[model samples]
Target: MAGIYIHIPFCKQACLYCNFHFSTNKKLIPQLVNAIAKEAFLRQDYLTETIETIYFGGGTPSILPTSDIVFLIDEIKKIFEVNSNTEITLEANPDDIDEANLVAWKKAGINRFSLGIQSFIDAELQWMNRSHNAKQAKHCIDLIKKYFTNYSIDLIFGSQLLSNEDWLVNIKTALSFNPPHLSCYALTIEEKTVLGNKVSKKVISNIDNEKQAQQFNILMKELAIAGFHHYEISNYAQPNFESKHNSSYWQSKHYLGLGPSAHSFNGSTRSWNIANNALYIQSIENNNLQIETEELTTTQQLNEYIMIALRTSGGINLNIIEERFGVTILLELKNKITAWLQANHIEQKNNFIQLTNLGKLYADGIAADLFF
Candidate 1:
């Protein structure tokens, strides 16, 4: 099954730690929505499989009008083979989650929501420069619980304002809502963001690695005790409630991504659109393709698979590696992982290499070390 990702590149305000391709300009919403719809029809033949998931991610997709959301979904349905049970997800911020909006989104075919709650502390929300307050966050979740069964909460840990006690409180507060899924991320400072500039100027201290690691361990322990599965490094979900769209991505399923700065991948080639909104709109209007493509070599594909699969609960499949990359390379991988195995980071169970809790913390580093 294939999936579709639509990026809405507008936001109500800028967050300190955000580096995604998004603008705070609301003036271009109508034009950008039309451009996105046009691009969708233009690239209708990009995926060969039936569409099983449609994810609206962004600069906060919930900021769009219900009419815009409906128009795009209708356009997509007319051009593609969408499944009856397709999982349609919209990433929303707490400030945009009023009851009226929730009702409209439901009618427009949004089956799931990924809320950017960030933190439950009022001071933390202010520190992050989020548009919503603590009360609004709780109220929005309450509204969602009444109407939606499959919803996810996003929380950030290791922030300057969040102590270890506050981190525990944040996780427990999220669990209080009994959400089906939770996506907890560490607040990493990117060079291009406001937070990064503060660190670079020495206005604030850099991330304390030990403190961050401790918070992550606390997260793993708390979530495990609460009966949530750590399916991906940054994602946790209850049984049968994992995000189909995001999971499809990790499994390397074919998908079409529409809008500025969005990436698409089939089995062999991957492509992305222009990051500039005006430029992307202009190219679509002129019927000019503004995307760049790359052909993945065998080693590149294997390394990519190794990087992604190791972050997941499924771990790496040695049999599939041998089949796809030949026995020589698979033997090399086996030899490479010996030290990791001895260090009690990763363990092989029935030929599948899964990470221990300790391994999860250094997952990315380990994946890079194991790359071909």
Candidate 2:
């Protein structure tokens, strides 16, 4: 099964740590939406299998009017074959979620929501420059619980302003809501963002990797004790609540992404649209989408598989690697795994190479070492 991702490249306000492609100018909303719809029709054949998920992700899909959202969904349906049980998720912010908006989104076929709650502390929210306050965050969760059953809450950990006590409170607040899923990410100061600029100018302290590691450990321990599956490195779910769309990506399934800065991937090829919103719209209007495409080399594919699978709970399936790449390559991988196994960084069971709790902290490095 495949998935479709529609990027809505507009937000009401810019967050300090955000480096996503979006414009605060609301005037381009109409043109952007229309261009996205056209893009859907243009790239309809990118996925050969049935579409199992359609994710409305972006700068902030929650800011779109209900009618516009409905129009885009309808347009996608008209052009593509969506599965009956497809999961349609909309990434929403706390401030945009109200009773009326929730009802409207449900009517527009958004069965799932990935709410950006960030933090429950007012000071933390202010520091991040999120548009919603702490009160709005709580209210949005309450409203979502009342209206929807399948939703995920996003939280950020490892900020300099957040103490251990504050981090505990954030987790406790999320647990109080009993959300089906939670995605926690450590704050990374990407270059060109406000937070990055502040750090460069010494106006704000940089993120502490040790503190971040501590918080990550705290998260894994608490969430596991709470009976949530640490399904992926940055994602947690209760039972069968894992995100299908994202899971498809990890499984190397084909997906088509529409809109500015969106990436599309088939098994052998990958492509992405230009990041500039105005340029994207103009190019599409001119009947020429400025996209860059690349065919994946065998080594690139093997490296990608290693990177994504290592971050997952199931780890890397040795048999699949052997089958796809070759037994020689698998043997080479096994030698590397043997070293890690001796170091207590990895465990081999039933031909799968899974990470140990301690090893997870250095997952990226281990994956890179194993890459051919």
Candidate 3:
């Protein structure tokens, strides 16, 4: 199955730690929406298979008017074979989750939501310069549960201002809603972001790796008790509630991405639209796509497979690797991972190799080491 990702590069305000490509200018909303719809028509043949998922990712898709969202969906349906049960998700912030918008979103064919509830702590929310307060974060869940059964909330851990006790309270507060899915991410200070600038100027302390690791352990243990499956390293889901769009990404399924800074991937080639919204609109108007294309080399593909699969619960399938690559490559991969196996960092079952609890801490490092 295939999927579509539409990047709405507009936001009300920039978060302190965000490094994503987005503008705070709401004036470009109309032009951007029309451009995205045009892009869908232009790239119709990117995926041959029926579309199973459509994700409206951000800069806060909920910030748009409901009518615009409906129009985009209708435009896509006109050109693509969208599955009747296709999972359509929109990313939202707590402040935008009013009854009016929620009802409108449901009516516009948005079956799921990914709420950006970074933390339920007022102080932490302030530190992150989030648009919503702690009260809004907690209150929005009740409103959301009333409408969408398949929704996910995002939480961040490892901020210097967040204590272990505070982190526990945040987790408990989110669990109180019993959300179908949770995506917990570590707070990373990316360059060019406000937090990154503060750290460089010594305005704030650097992140504590030890503290982050401790919080991750707490998240895993608590979520497991609450019956959430840790399907991916950063994602947890209740039974049958996994993110179909993201799962398709991990499985290397073909997907078409529209709008500024969005990416697309078929099996052999990958492409991304220009990050500048003005440039994107201009190019679309000129009937030209401002995108860069790359045909992945065999080694590049194998390395990518290793990186993605290793971070997942499925780990790396040796037989699939052997079948797709070669037996020689599989043997070489096994030999490369012998050290990690001996170190008790990874365990192998009949045909799958998965990271152990201890190994998960160094997942990126291990995955890099195993890359072809």
Which number leads on lDDT? 1
lDDT-superior candidate, 1 or 2: 1
Question: How does candidate 1 fare on TM-score?
Answer: 0.99
lDDT ranking from best to worst? 1, 3, 2
Sliding window of 10 residues with minimal summed lDDT for model 1 = 40-49
lDDT of 3: 0.93
Residue 105 error for model 3, in Å? 1.0
lDDT (Cα, tens digit) per residue for candidate 2, span 264-368 = 998899999999999999999988989999999999999999999999999999999999999999989988888899999899889889998888888989999
Cα lDDT listed for each candidate: 0.94, 0.93, 0.93
Residue 50 of model 3, lDDT score? 95
RMSD of every prediction: 0.7, 0.9, 0.8
Where does candidate 3 clash, by residue pair? none
Candidate 2 residue pairs in backbone clash: none
Off by over 4 Å in 2: none
